[model samples]
Target chain A: MFVQATESSTGVSHDVARLGRLVRGLPETALVVDAITGLGTTDLQPDEWGLDIVIGGSQKALMVPPGLAFLGVSEKAWKLIERSKLPRFYFNLARERKAQSKSEVSFTPATTLVVALHTALEYIRSMGREKLIANAAMLAEATRAAASALGLGLFAESSPANALTAVSAPAGMDSGAIIKELRARFGAIVANGQGSMKGKIFRIAHLGYYDAPDMFALIASLEIVLTKLGHTCELGAGVARAQEVYLGFVEQEAQAAQAGRP
Target chain B: MFVQATESSTGVSHDVARLGRLVRGLPETALVVDAITGLGTTDLQPDEWGLDIVIGGSQKALMVPPGLAFLGVSEKAWKLIERSKLPRFYFNLARERKAQSKSEVSFTPATTLVVALHTALEYIRSMGREKLIANAAMLAEATRAAASALGLGLFAESSPANALTAVSAPAGMDSGAIIKELRARFGAIVANGQGSMKGKIFRIAHLGYYDAPDMFALIASLEIVLTKLGHTCELGAGVARAQEVYLGFVEQEAQAAQAGRP
Candidate 1:
């Protein structure tokens, strides 16, 4: 089992492709579980990645209450579940699958949270999964470019997730302090470094339920935070970079469409 | 380890005494962890229950996202922590204690969910913990009496949790069907039987973020459901019974206060 999380907060597309190659190479690995990582900020198609199992939670890119976990199982993984012996009393994939056939849950499901998750998924499906993924990727690309223009580096040196763009604080500035200031002064909820990089980096999420304007506002806020924290960053540089990335994405997609014309 | 979740959602003063006896009986029971089953919907004092570790999650009575888990540990539990070696990497109680000392979280905490949990807890604290529990118990008591009057039987039979009333559906009717109808027709969400009782019983929750009106509303909805499904039930009977329970609870509390007056 290979567990790969879709973490493209800044729309790094390379990681998904890299994962595809890794999955193709592993023969003994019965399942490849994408922990909503392939979607990046944009919701990626399961078929597109050729993944066996895609595990998604309600809170992340789904933008709903956190109770339900959605798993899209491939035929291969489904067959292997019969032999997979992980001690799962509550999160049993087989039980959930059986219940799902009748539009029900195996356990006494969290009624209210499941309802919320259902509603959120419905909205995402209605928006068209392709479009949602594209929007997320575009948002991530824009955010990353904006952060780069501010002279701050990204946490993931390569192959970043499109859901959030982890930005490094300039030399001598504390990323933790910047996160606190952003929350205290602006009331904007952004993420910080996880695991070993707690004070070394900060994260800006551009996932579900966000737009271009939100990104622009966030960039502007970051610029202020950088300046107040004694970091020398051009006032409009971040926003301008974000705009450039957005325009570039639109142009590339348009060109691709024109090229596909028979 | 004998885990005894508090029986009632709004556990009565008598329930606390019962729990005390249960806790005192166990030997080598280094920890008395209180899941406080109905604590969210009912009133509780950690001190009153003689709880060594009180555990709570954000979904039930604390109307918030589900990622946050709160634990209030006693000195005895803290001392035992020096000996616990149960391969717990994610939920390390000792790490959490250290973080709490500095008013922080041990791991990469679910920042958004914690914010939501804080808001919900604040709402409860503002309403007054005693009043909140009393209100939940009153509503639950009413729900139970109303359910019984309507020819329904309690599922937990001998000891029903006050946070939610679980009722066994009539022999011919599917409990799942009743649960589905309550949500589909009345836009009300009720719980279904958990574990072994799936499809056999339905639950009506009347805990946090609820009042007498809410409980009565569910009772009235249940009556409609019973009538439509061929059970003999008069509309308003359940609601009236629930109302009587609420009034009785208030009167009893008033009498107890008067008797203990200085």
Candidate 2:
């Protein structure tokens, strides 16, 4: 099995299309993709990418409580599962697939969470999936722009994630201090780096249920937090950059509408 | 140096009092306890037990979302943290302690979750901590009794947890089937076993935001699911046993009140 856990620790998504080409060489290999944080952040084509098994969680892009998980299985994966020797029960994909085929679940489904996920899915559908993906990408672009405006460095040197922006902390200043000030002073909660990267970087997420106004508020708060932490920068520089990103999108939409007018 | 992660995967709580005795021999060692699921499930005496570091999450007994985590530090633990060489940043307990000393958090705190936790804490206080622990214990006892009445076996043989009851599936029957039927037929969501124990057992949680009526309803549903799954049992057997447990508690409380009358 070729297991590819997409979406990095810093929120960067892997190039699955490139990975798919490699998988084509190993025709018999089962490709398992962990799309936990990738689903709403970017456009994913499992079939096109030859992704055999794609896993997702409800908490991230689905905007629900943590309990339910989703899986996308291909025909090749189903055949592989049939011949697999792994002793499985609760997480048995074949069992779930059989039940799903009958419009049911193999185990006790998280009913409340399923309802919440359904509602979130409906909202995403209404907004259009392509538009939702674009919204995340645009917000991520805005965040990167804002961070640059604040004279901060990007943590992900290559293939930065659309779900969140990881920014390097200023020299000799702990990112934890910035995170602390944001919450204490303005009640804004941002994530600091995980594991070994802690204190070196901070992350701001713009994926799923986030919009331009939320980005504006976050950037504004960030600017205040950075200043409070003794980082010398002009007030509203980050917010202004983010605002420009939003305005650019609005302008594009307006021009598109005008071009299509009867 | 010496860390102890308390709380079991099966929801059982360890005997901290006994563990504390062992820790006393190693004076310089830090006693780190994962009290995430143990806090509301059982009586935890951190200070008295000389527990150096006690960790907790907002979910489980706290009845909040799964973003916020809390830590209780001791003076002895602080000394260890000061000299610790382990590369630390986001989970730096020292930084959190320092920030908390000033009524702040070291990272972007989950603001909404913190607020919800605060409300939950207030409710816990109103109900009284001892009473809360007793409630979980009572509910767990009732569940065990009900399961026994239904001819089901307990998974935890020696140290059963007050948070949840793990029950073994009947011979030749998959617990997953029971879990599925419960959800599909009655909208009740119970958890099946994890890993190796899957298909053999199921778990029913009695911790956090649960009452006697909830237990009654759960048992009633379990009876229906078991019957539908070809398990031979008298209808309402489990529920009747649960009701008896509740009635016993009421009788005891009435007797206590009568004895207290001057």
Model 2 C-alpha lDDT per residue in residues A5-117, reported as the tens digit of each score? 43545866678777766775775787787877778877788888788888878777767766667888888788878888875666688878788888977654545567778
Model 1 TM-score relative to the real fold: 0.72
Question: Taking candidate 1, what TM-score does its chain B reach relative to the real chain B?
Answer: 0.85
Best-fitting candidate, measured by DockQ?
1
What 10-residue stretch in candidate 1 chain B is worst by lDDT?
B6-15
Top candidate (TM-score)? 1
- The reply for model 2, stretches above 4 Å from the true place, is A1-262, B1-8, B255-262
Which of the CAPRI classes, incorrect, acceptable, medium or high, describes model 1? incorrect
Residue B206 lDDT in candidate 1: 66
| Residue-level lDDT for B183 in candidate 1 | 88
lDDT of 2 by residue, B1-262 (tens): 3333333446455677778767757857877887777778888787898888888777778777665667888888888788998866776877877788889776544355667889999999998887777778889899999999999998885778888888999999999999999889888888888779889888888777888988899899888888888899999888888888888987887898799999
TM-score of 2: 0.58
